[model samples]
Target: MPTDASNFSVTMVIRSILYTTQQASESPYNYVPTEWVCIFFLTAYSISTAIHMGQALRYKLWWMIPTVTFAGILEIFGWSCRLWSSQSPELLRPFEMQLFGTILAPTPLVAAYFIIFGRITIHFGPQFSRLTPNMYIIVFFSLDTICLTIQAVGSVFAAEAVNEYKSPTLGGNIMLGGISAQLFAIWVYLGLAAEFFLRRKYNAPFRRQVIKFGKGQRSMSKDVQCMIYALGFCTICIIIRSVYRTVELADGWSGTVISTESYFNWLDGGFVVVAMYTLNVIHPGIYLKSVDTSLPDEDKVNLSYVF
Candidate 1:
């Protein structure tokens, strides 16, 4: 491996050469991520998506297909781009592709997590919830959409940035803002979920009725139990991912932590991948049976990728 200075100087020379030749300008720096790590995540997320697809189709989970499908696609494709950059570090295209794709990939996955809460609440009877089950899907997901769009737009701007020549601060700040918004949204959603569970656990309205209704869940079924566990685990996993993004982005786009591939794989990629697989194994679609199609249109996917 060449020294950092040599690597940078070579990149500068290449950029200058491209400029003189009137060729498309490229980023002067190459990330050069480890190939094995990229392959590992790509393969894992792909298999997870395939399994989730089978389960979704088996249970007719139309609402979840968009969220699950897009996340898997984005993660797999983003990692593939990383593989490209590792092989040919001088090319700028792969870096641009991975930048926004990987960052925006988890947005839909987090939406899936938010949807699970609403469904679980409905299963247990929304009356025990501090807010209606509908509220969870409507409010939190709207916030999710905002966060997703902001981050995506910010990434686009960042990708257009010329390394060592242009400032990425504007785009970086927008991305950071989106991440901040997501952190707030998920934390609030978690608080609501915790409140609902506690309210049901303690002496609250419908406490006695809810207990007698299902004989403490014998009537509600095992799927309900599974949904509870799945939701809890998924929340924790995604929270770790969001926190990682927030901290990593705060350090600036080219900060040491963000520049380190291993750390990112462990925190961002690892956290979301575990959550996706865990959700697949404990699939709510397997147990949810049938949701009311008559429920507000916003709750269903209906071709909306972000919601």
Candidate 2:
């Protein structure tokens, strides 16, 4: 039989081997993230952020400046972390930073969209909207705040669990709840958007109101129309991204959705890239003018007034 000291040494060697094996087996990203892909995203976000800052400054789009800039910066940071993670896939810090940064980045961007839609409603006429222009911002932004909080807290727990080399089921579930709530809010917002458009198209009195920068009764300016179309496209892309994230988290950390990097590259990263660039091409600052504040609000129908 081995002496006690030798036995202890043997046991320590076995434990060391097992610990290394566990570390090797537990990758935050099941597959190593592609380096080139991460670089592409990082570069793209950096350029877009520069463009957004210039536009916001030029047009004095004070409301959009912070939200869009913040989103772009977060995206840049996240992608940079991803690039670092690709190099050091075994490291926990990069994974934690990328995961938290990417997940939370879009929240501000989505808030910017809400504000855009609210401004659009005001531009067309708030009376045509079901919940009024301001209510759209109020209701959706409040829900967004709640969801953001949930997601932030959940991400911390998930990161801790990952550090401890345990299953992130509880944290994942919490994140799912938050993301699911966000999805529901997006759907409802779409419904309200539909209602606003339908009301504007079919409502007789509003149709007769003098159209802005257009000759015909129902015609909107080409710029406004383009802005509206761009907003719609962005909304669709965001929906796709949100759905992808929701499903990814729902399938647990070790599941197929998270295991495959392609789904994330396309559904999550691709969609957002498309959306951000689409906005850059058809920028709201250039296409969408300020709401005509001179117009009377006597006919406005707010949710507060209804209740």
Most accurate candidate by lDDT: 2
CA lDDT scores, all candidates in order:
0.74, 0.79
Model 1: per-residue Cα lDDT over 1-307, one tens digit each: 7999999999999998776334212322324567788888889988998988888788877767788767878888888887787666667678778877888888888888878778777656465676666778888888989999999999888778734347777887889999899988888887878887777767464322322322243134666677778778878887788788888878876677776667788988898899889878788776565334323454343311111
Q: Which residue pairs collide in model 2, if any? A: none
Which regions of candidate 1 deviate over 4 angstroms?
A: 1-30, 206-220, 290-307
Q: Estimate each model's TM-score.
A: 0.79, 0.83
Assess candidate 2 and give its TM-score to the true structure. 0.83
The digit string of per-residue lDDT tens for model 2 on 1-307 reads 8899999999999999886556546668876778899999899889988988888888888866667778788888888998998877888889888888788777777888888889787656555677766877899988988988888888888888888988778888888888888888888998988888887788632222323323233345788888889888988998999999999998889889988888998998888878888888888777775343323354232213232
